[model samples]
Target: MARKAAIIGGGVIGGGWAARFLLNGWDVAVFDPDPEAPRKVGEVIANARQALPALSDVPMPAEGKLSFVSTITEAVEGSEYIQESVSERLDLKHRVFAQIQQVAPGVLIGSSTSGFKPSELQEKAPEPGMIFVAHPFNPVYLLPLAEVVPSPKNPPEAIERAKEILREIGMFPLHVRKEIDAHIADRFLEAVWREALWLVKDGIATTEEIDEAIRMGFGLRWGQMGLFETYRVAGGEAGMKHFMAQFGPCLTWPWTKLMDVPEFNDELVDLIAGQSDAQSGHHSIRELERIRDSNLIGFLRALKERNWGAGKVLREHDERKAAAFFGATDSAPKAAPLEMAHMQVLPGWIDYNGHMTESRYYFANSETIDAFLRLIGAGMDYVAAGHSYYSAETHIRHLGEAKLGDRLTGTIQIISADEKRFRSFVRIMKGEDCVATIEQLCLHVDMAAGKSSPASAEVWAKLKAVADAHANLPLPEGAGRAVGQRK
Candidate 1:
């Protein structure tokens, strides 16, 4: 059954909540009094459509229905979850919760409040035990960290349910142990924000300079290793104890003015805004967002190879996706050749001619092989078991041009299979037209030994089954053709 969620506000955070739910196959009913709510949410969804899929190769659930309702009552009537993202005002939140409780009190309700603690928020709720704070970072669809804070009044089951739901949508839910304003991540963020403001106020560093300092040095380290872990690495042979002993004294030095906040007067605001403009005025907001998303995808993909931090999260999600694909009963049609890969040309893969680049054809072939590997019960778990298939050689023949935005499909036919060697041919097409073809030879090996080896009994049986199924098909036209000039 398709679950439904109600979003009480449709600003940035609310819109993000909508995208997260909708993309995960939850019907979303959004209620916001603002006249431009639909347009705002639509824009956020557009950005999400471009960014989220780039994070993983998984085929996400088909997007659920999105409806903009005029009344909060209409939105919450049949909702399984209700997320409140209105302005950060206690009065307004109290009123909204009162209305929600009047209609749907038992639904799992969460408040996207960065500043308010769950205890404070619950005090105003009609059903305090059911609501908690579910704060998330900006561009919520891309970033997976969600802080789930439950107050003393809230039930433990609510916290567990929230964690389960967040994980289902690929979020890392950090359960704040106690009620505290700003939560965990934001506390660190606020400290940095305070110091940056002081730096600007004292004429020590411009906005761009401060940003460069973070991005060029500690920022990259923090992204993968985090603060204490990075410090532990810096400790060399000793570890965290040594690091704290060496640098703990520096914490008391007159280096930062975190105890006091700079007044946000007009002059200071103008100065900061002007410096920001001088730094990034050339690019539009949308252009800047695209740049940020692209960089995040690239960096996360690199980290994924090492299976570190956020990369580990991405890898685990991919494994889950592969598991679901292999376990599905209603698979591809039992035809002569199974459709192995179905994807659109991503914007980043285009060449000068606005078509998919030549190298991407081989990459697509590799992906096709991966899809087949998952189907044959040789997926991440198989590789983790120290056995995997490695490509020995590939021959690709381009038949036609594949333009950007073209939907491509790869159909596979197993040419032959043995104890250690498996060969397959894949035909890549754009809808009805054949665009390219690839012939690949792969060897099954004990990855730990790093040498060719016979496949395990189970894998061999699966491969033999596929080979038998494909044996009836006639040889393809270009199966053994050479690329050299013919006499």
Candidate 2:
């Protein structure tokens, strides 16, 4: 059964929580007093649908059902997890918790308060142990960090369970050791925010200038290596110890107004707001959000390729999905086109004409063929061991259009095989319809010598079995046809 998550507020953070859980295959029930909550949350989910799948190497799980409920009571019904993202008012949060505990005191409840400590949130509560902090950054569906703060009143097991749930939804839960005013990340950000305000207030820099200083410089470094590591690299060959010794003394300098506060008057607000409007007012919030999402996807995918930092979290998620796929799979030969891969048409896959591009069609086929190769033991490890199958030629036929968000299935039918070479056919399907077909010839090679080579005995046995099963089936219509051939 699909697990359920209750989202107490449907603003940006709450909606992001909904999307994260829903996309990870958890049914979500959302409750927000705003009458426009449905439209608001729907927009966030639409952004998430395009952004999240692009990060995964494996197919995303079947999306869970999303429902907007009338009350907190309706939202928390049968919920295994609940995230409260209501307004930042203390009394408002206390009342929200009281209502939640009144009905379902046992269900784990988390708060998305960026500034409030867990102790503050847990006070005046009948079930304080169930209420803790789970502060996430904006665009929670894309970014992975969740600052989980638990007071001493909370049980260890419950806190661990909270972390596990966060990880399951592809979040990296940084457990805050003690209850601090604004958990780790926010504190650092608050310092930067204050400094940025001072810079604008003092006419030292414009909004766009500050943004450029970050994005063109440290922001790129920060995205991958983060603050300490980036500075550590700044230390040169001696590492962090050398860095701290050299730059640590600069901490006492009056380089920043870390201790000073700018007066918060109309003048200050207007300076910042007007500058920001001039900096980014041309694009609507949604348009800027799309731009941000696209940039983040590119950055995160780069990290995933290197298997470093936030990318590592994404890879682990894919690994978890792969484990489940293999454990439940029975790959014995059968008289059918073997379903090898499941894919989605992501944001970058569309061409100028708005159809899935031709390259992606070949990519879809390659994914199908690669999965089949892995199943038959001629995969990456086999290549690393100096023997593998390499595609010599391919022919693809596009029969129908596949638009964005369309789910695709790639299935393979083996036509024939020998010791050193094999021919196969693949069909990319959308539901019951086949959108395209690909036929390919592959040759096993001795990598060191760069010549055709016989397959390993074990791989040959498996491949021959599947090939033998497919031999009795009628040949796929386009199997041997050359380009521009008649019907």
Candidate 3:
């Protein structure tokens, strides 16, 4: 059954939380008095629908239902979890909690409060243990961190449940050691934000210049190797201990107004706002969001390649989902093309011709074949053991074009196979239409000896079964065509 989550507000943060839940296959009920809430939340979900799938190696779960409810009771009733993101007013949050408890008293309630601690939020609350903090970053659907803060009143079982739920939606739940104002990540961000303000206020830098410094320098390092680790690398021959000792004196330096505050006034606001407007005013908010999402996708994918930092979370999520989606059973393949891969044409997949680049079409087929190989017990472990399949020849035929945001499927039909080699036909489809086809021949090899070799009995048993199943099917049209063959 699809789980249900209640979102008490539908502003940006709330909308983001709604998208995260909905995309992760949780039905969501959002309660926000703003008349424009649906349209606003819809836009965030649209961005999510475009961006999140590109990060997944396996097919994403079917999106769950979303509804804008009239009241907190309607939103919370029957919900397995509730994420309160109402305005940052304690009284307002307390009232929302009161109403929520009247219906579903024990459901897990996570607050998307960036500043407030769990203790303050739990005050005067019945079942305060369930009402802890789940602070997520902006673009919650993409960035995975959710700082989970639990009060002493919150039991260990409930806190563990909260962390597990966050993981199911592909979030990294950093359990706060103790409930404190602003949790962990935001505390660092607040410091940076304050310093940025002081920089602009004192004419040290404009908003654009400060942003440039971060995105162009340490921000890149921090993307994968966060603060201490990045500094550890800067330690060069020595490690973090040596580096810390060397730079410890800089902590007392007056280089930053870390302890001081710039007067929160119109002048500072205007200076920052006016400079920000000049910096990125050309793009609309939606444009900026799309830009940010695309850039993040690239960076995160790089991290995923290294299986480091946030990428490890993404990879682990993919492995779990793939195993569940493609059940390890069914070793005997059916007499048809096995649908092995699901992918979307992300913004990064486009070319100047405004269609999915030719390379991605080929990539789709490779992904499909790779999945099929995994099915036959000849995956990474086989490769690690110095025995693997190597593509010997490939022929790609493009029938139609795929553009950005198009959902694509890749399926493989095993044409023939023996102990050492196999011939396969793969289709790259957009909806019901075959946008392209790939014909490839592969040979099993003993990598250590650098020679083609017969597949092991166990692997061959699985591979031959699938190949024999497809043997009776007619030859795919144009399967053996030459490079310049006619239609």
TM-scores vs. true structure, each candidate: 0.84, 0.96, 0.89
Score each candidate by Cα lDDT: 0.86, 0.92, 0.90
List, residue by residue over 136-206, the lDDT tens digit for candidate 1.
99888878888999988888988899888888878888899898889888899999999999899889999
| Residue 217 lDDT (model 3) | 99
What stretches of model 2 exceed 4 Å from their correct place? Answer: 325-330
How many residue pairs clash (N, CA or C atoms closer than 3 angstroms) in each of the candidate models, in the order given?
0, 0, 0
Candidate 2 lDDT tens digits, 1-487: 9999999999999999999999999999999999999999999999999899888877678899999989899999899999999999999999999999998878899999989989899898998899999999889999999999999989989999999999999999999999999899989998999999999988899999999999999999999999999999999999999999999999999899988989999999988999999999999998998899999999999999999999999999999876754444337788988988878787788898889999999999998888899899988999899998889998999889999778898899999999999999999999999999999999999999999999999999999999998889999987788889999
lDDT of 3 by residue, 101-198 (tens): 88898899999998999999988898888899999988999999999998889989998998998999999999998878888888899999999989
Instruction: Provide the lowest-lDDT 10-residue window in model 1.
Output: 326-335
Model 3, residue 366: C-alpha shift (Å): 2.3
Better of 2 and 3 by lDDT: 2
Q: Candidate 3: where is the Cα deviation over 4 Å?
A: 333-357, 384-387, 396-411, 428-436, 444-462, 477-487
